[model samples]
Target: MIDSHAHIYLEHFEEDVEEVVERAIANGVEKILLPNIDSTSIEQMLRLEEQYPDVCYPMMGLHPCSVKEDFEKELQIVEDWFNKRSFLAVGEMGTDLYWDKTFWEQQKEAFHFQCELALKHDLPIVIHCRETIDETILLVEQYEGKGLKGVFHCFTGTVDQARQITNLGFFLGLGGVSTFKNGGMDKVIPHLERSKIMLETDSPYLTPAPHRGKRNEPSYISLVADKVAEFLNLSRKELDDLTTANTNKLFFPSK
Candidate 1:
C-alpha cells in the first residue's frame, strides 16, 4: 500500500527515522510520499528522499500556513527546486484559515502559482485545505480545462464537496481523521466512489485510532485502511489494491 502523504522527514522522527521506515514497510506500506512545507524543509525532505530513493518520494511546494508577506520569494524558491528536479507532485499546497489569517491573500496566490506549476510540469498536486475547502475548490475551478489533477490531501469535506473535487478529476485523500468516532468521515466515505479515494496517514500528525494520542507514523496506515475497508464493506486487501491503483493513476501515470 502507498502512504500518499507523510512528513517523516521532519525532526519529528529524528531519533529513529530508520525504525519508523522499517515499521512502515513491515506494516506493508510500499511507498511514503513526502510533501515540502517551505524552503526550510527542502533540505531534510530531499535528504530523506535521497536515502530512500523510490520508496520515499518527495513533492515540492510552499505549504499554505507557511505563506507569508514575502511569499513571492518563497515561491521563487519553490519554482527553482522544480527546475532542479522532478517531484511526485506540486504540493501540499492550498489555503488554511484554521491558523492565522494574516497571510490569507498570499496563501491563495501561492496556491494558484503552485497549481500553474503543476500544470506546467504535467504533475499532480497534493492539497492541504484547512477551513478553506470552498475557497480552495473555487480556485481549482478556475483551472478546469487546464489539465489540473491531484488529491485534496487530508480531505474532511462534505459529501457534496467530495463530489465537486472528484468531478474535477481530483481524488480525496482519507487519513486518520476518518477513523475518529466524531470525525464525520464515516458518514461520507461510504457515499463517495471508491475509485476517487486514496489513503494517507499525514503522519507525524493525525495518527489513526487505537493509537490516536501517539505521534503518527506510516505504519499506522494499516489501521486507517482497516477502518476504510470496514465502512466500505471491503477486505483490507481489496481496499489497498483499489486505493493503490487510484494513487498510481494520479502520481505515477507514466507507469
Candidate 2:
C-alpha cells in the first residue's frame, strides 16, 4: 500500500518520526509521498526523504493556502528546487477557498503555473482542492489534452464531478474522509470505478473514523483501505491491490 500524501515532516511528528514510519511499514504502507507546503517546509521534507530514501518520496510545489502576496518569490524558490533535484510530482498545489480568499487570484495563478511545471517535468501532480472543486476542475479542463495528469488529493466531490475529473485523465485520491459517516464518499466511491481511484492518508489531518479527531499518521491508512473496501464490496486485499497498483503506476510507473 502507499500513503499517497502525508506531512510527516511537520513538527507534529518531531518526537517520534521513526516510530511513525515503522508503524506504516509494519501495516504494509510501502511508500509515503510528502508534499511541499512552502519555502519553510522544504528543508524538513527533504531531510525526511534523505533519511527514508525510497520509502518516502518528496514532491515540490507551493500549497494554495500558502500562496501569499509575494508568491512569485516562493515559486522561484520552488523552481530552484526542481533544478536541484527530481521530485515525484509538482504538487500539493491547487486552489483552496475554504481557508482564505485573500490570495485567491494568486492561488489560481500558482496552480496553473505548477500544472505547467508538471507537464514540463513530465511528472504527475498531486492536487489539493478545498471548497474550490468546480473552479479547480474548470482550470484543469483547459489543459486536458495538453498531457496533464494528476490526482485530486483528498477528493470529496459528487459522482458527476468524479467522472469529469477521471474523463480528463486524472485520478481521485481517497483517504480518511471516505470512512466518515457523513463524508459523502460512501455515496461517491461505489458509483465510481476503482481504476480511477487511489489511496492516501493526508495524514496529520483527516484521521479516519474510530480514530477521528486524533492526530493522523500513515500507519492508520489501513483503516482507510478497510473502509473503502467495505463500501466497494471488495475484500481489503483487493482494494489494497487495486489502489496500490494505481498509485505505483502514477508515481513509479517504470516499476
Candidate 3:
C-alpha cells in the first residue's frame, strides 16, 4: 500500500520518526509522499527524503494556509528548491477558507501559481482544499487539458463533487477521515469507482478510529485501508491492491 500523502517530517514525530516509518512498512505501507507546507518546512522534508530515499518522496509548494503577504517570496523559494532537485509533485497547494478568509485572494493567487508550476514541470499535484471546493474546482477546471494531474488530498466532498473531480482526470485521496464514525466519506466512497481513489494518512493529523485525538502516524494507514475494504465489501488485500495501483498510476506512472 502507498500513503499517498503525509507530513511525517513535522516535529510531532521528532522522537520516534524511524519507528513510525518502520511500523508503517510492517503494516504493508510501501511508499509515503510528503507534501511541503512552506519555506520553513523544506529543509526538514528534504532531510527526511534523504534519510529514507525509497520510502519518502518530497513535494514542493506553499500550503494554502501558509499564504500571506510575503507569499510571492515563499513561492520563489519553493521554485528555487525545485530547480535544485527533482520533486515528485508541486503541491499541498490549494484554497482554504476555513481558517482565515482574510487572505482568500492571496491564497487563490498562490494556488494558481503553483498549478502553473506543476504544468511547467509536468508533475502531478497534491491539492489541499479546505472549505473551498467550489473555488478549488473552478481553478482546477481552468487547467483542464494542460496535463494537470493530481489527487484531491483528504477528500471530504459530495458524490457529485467526486464525480466532477474524477471526470477532470484527478483522483480522490482517502485518508483517516474515512474511518470516522460519522464522516460523510462513507457515502462519498460508495459513489466513487475504486479506480478513481487513492489511499493516504495525512499523518500526524487525522488519526483513525480507536486512535482518534492521538498524534497520527503512518502505521495507522492500515486502519484506513481496513475501513475502505469494509466500505467496498472487499478483502483488505483486494482494497490495498486497487488503491496501490491507483497511486502508482498517479505518482509513479511508469511503474
lDDT of 3 by residue, 116-197 (tens): 8888888998899999887899999998887899999999999999889999999999999899999978887877878989
Q: How high is each candidate's TM-score?
A: 0.99, 0.99, 0.98
Tell me the tens digit of each residue's lDDT in model 2 across 1-255.
999999999999999999999999999999999999999999999999999997999999999988998899999999988988899999889999988989888898999899888988999988899999999999999997899899999999999999999999899999999999999898889998678899888989999999999999999999999989999999999999999999988889898
Name the 10 consecutive residues with the lowest summed lDDT in model 1.
103-112
User: Lowest-lDDT window of 10 residues in candidate 2?
Assistant: 192-201
Per-residue lDDT of 163 in model 3? 87
What are the root-mean-square deviations of the candidates from the true structure over C-alphas? 0.7, 0.7, 0.8
Question: Candidates' lDDT values, in order?
Answer: 0.92, 0.92, 0.90
Off by over 4 Å in 3: none
Deviating ranges (above 4 Å) for candidate 1: none
Clashes of 2: 0
Error of 1 at 152 (Å): 0.4
